[model samples]
Target: MEWTLPQWGQLMTLFMIAIAMGMDAFSLGIGVGMRGILLRQAILVSITIGFFHTVMPLAGMVIGRVLGLFVEKIAVMVGGGLLIFLGVNMLYHARKQGEAGVLRDLASFWGIFLFSVSVSLDSLSAGLTLGLFEADTLLTMLLFGWMGMLMAGAGLLLGRRVGAWIGGYGEAVGGMILIGLGLRFLL
Candidate 1:
């Protein structure tokens, strides 16, 4: 078994990447927190997203390794598609909100999990990219997950404050972000 530390420069690269990757989640988290979800619910949402951040990329890596040169676009397309769908769905729900909210309390764990998974689909695609570099999966996941947690925690706080002011429009914007990211990957 080989246990490797991330190269000092790779660690920096991953850290910056982590922040970039967390942008969507941060935006979504703001909306979630603004909806008046309890602290416990926010933590659950964070954990779910973090877990997906770890797993999706690992899965992508495994698949990419097997499929070799043929998998990047597939992973990217899948990831981008899912993000757009999630974002669009969020916007739709927001449009239906009563000017004050979109998502309700986070009592539904499965719902949270699925949302987390959808947003992190791009992370899987990113993981495939990382795998091509022979990066350490465990280290990579740890870096990604921690970055998500920090960003999400901040977003939850900020979203709670901002969501109330913007109402469901925040969610609608988040939806747009998802769609934009997906399109970006395609081009």
Candidate 2:
């Protein structure tokens, strides 16, 4: 079957959004990578992050679906507002310095779990907003999980070889992407 222009656009949008959501994972992975993680540990951590990214957004989408039932007319506005809020929050945190002890103990199960959840929180928010739209659920989730895993894995490996400066900038770029998307929704 052939695809239409709008379908292609939607696919691209979802793909970009998935990458944006993974930026946090990538940034944090860089931090962890800088600390010297084993390949095994990195793989495990990446899988965990991918799981959270998938689940969180799905949960958000469910909630969003419920909300859409009550406020169909204003759902778009609410979604846009949420996206903007999440983006600004990301930007704010990205500007902060001091990574001392922020990424310690990632070797522990609890530590890894907490870190994964924290990074995937934005995916939840993005999912909530997406719930308002006619987004393809399976495709979105797959993109998010896959990108989150790949990005995190890359970050961890790169962290060992690169400087810590990339983490903050990565988050900032992700924030900008989110903000731009939010504005697009509003307009």
Candidate 3:
């Protein structure tokens, strides 16, 4: 297939969307990394989160593709709402950190899985939106997965350096970023 200007635009759009979707994972990874994870553990956690980022969106696209025929309009709205809900939930958790249950260690299997799911929820919604628009599935998923992995790694490393200075505020900042992104999507 010949690459056209419109196709380039679509690719760029998908790349931006992938980065946006990965922001959640990156932000949350920062929050968790603040607790001081080792290098090996960081690698493991990032990989797991990246894997979920890919899987969740792929699953969403499959479901959304089927549903798109019936409720394309509704799917976009639902996607927006889901992003808002996830953002608000993260903010709530950040605000109530003391009252909230202790976060699980990312080094553990269950901990990694739970964290991965929490971060990847937004990707699912994004995939749904992409499907509603009938975007290229393979390219979208690949970008999402790749960006998620890189962003998570970067966040973890950054957090390790600055986490102590930020203290508990890391999560709050992360939550704010997510909330802003969600509102942007809605508007």
Output the number of the TM-score-best candidate: 2
Q: lDDT for model 1, on a 0 to 1 scale? A: 0.66
C-alpha displacement of 76 in model 2, angstroms? 0.9
Residue-pair clashes per candidate: 1, 0, 0
Model 1: CA > 4 A from native: 1-6, 69-105, 163-187
TM-score per candidate: 0.64, 0.95, 0.76
Quote model 2's TM-score: 0.95
The 10-residue segment of model 2 with minimum total lDDT is 96-105
What Cα-based lDDT does every candidate model obtain?
Answer: 0.66, 0.87, 0.72
For residues 29-141, write the lDDT of model 3, one tens digit per residue: 66667678899988888888788878878888888789888986776566556656655765676567556544557767898888878778778877876676677888988
Residue lDDT tens for model 1, 80-179:
5655665576677667655543344468866886778865776786676556555667877887787777666677777666645554554566567656
lDDT value, candidate 2, whole model: 0.87
Higher-lDDT candidate among 1 and 2? 2
Task: Name the regions of candidate 3 deviating beyond 4 angstroms.
Answer: 72-102, 164-187
Output the lDDT of residue 56, model 1: 80
Query: Across residues 17-101, which tens digit of lDDT does each residue of candidate 2 receive?
Result: 9988888888888888998999999999999999999999999899898999999999989988888888888788788734333
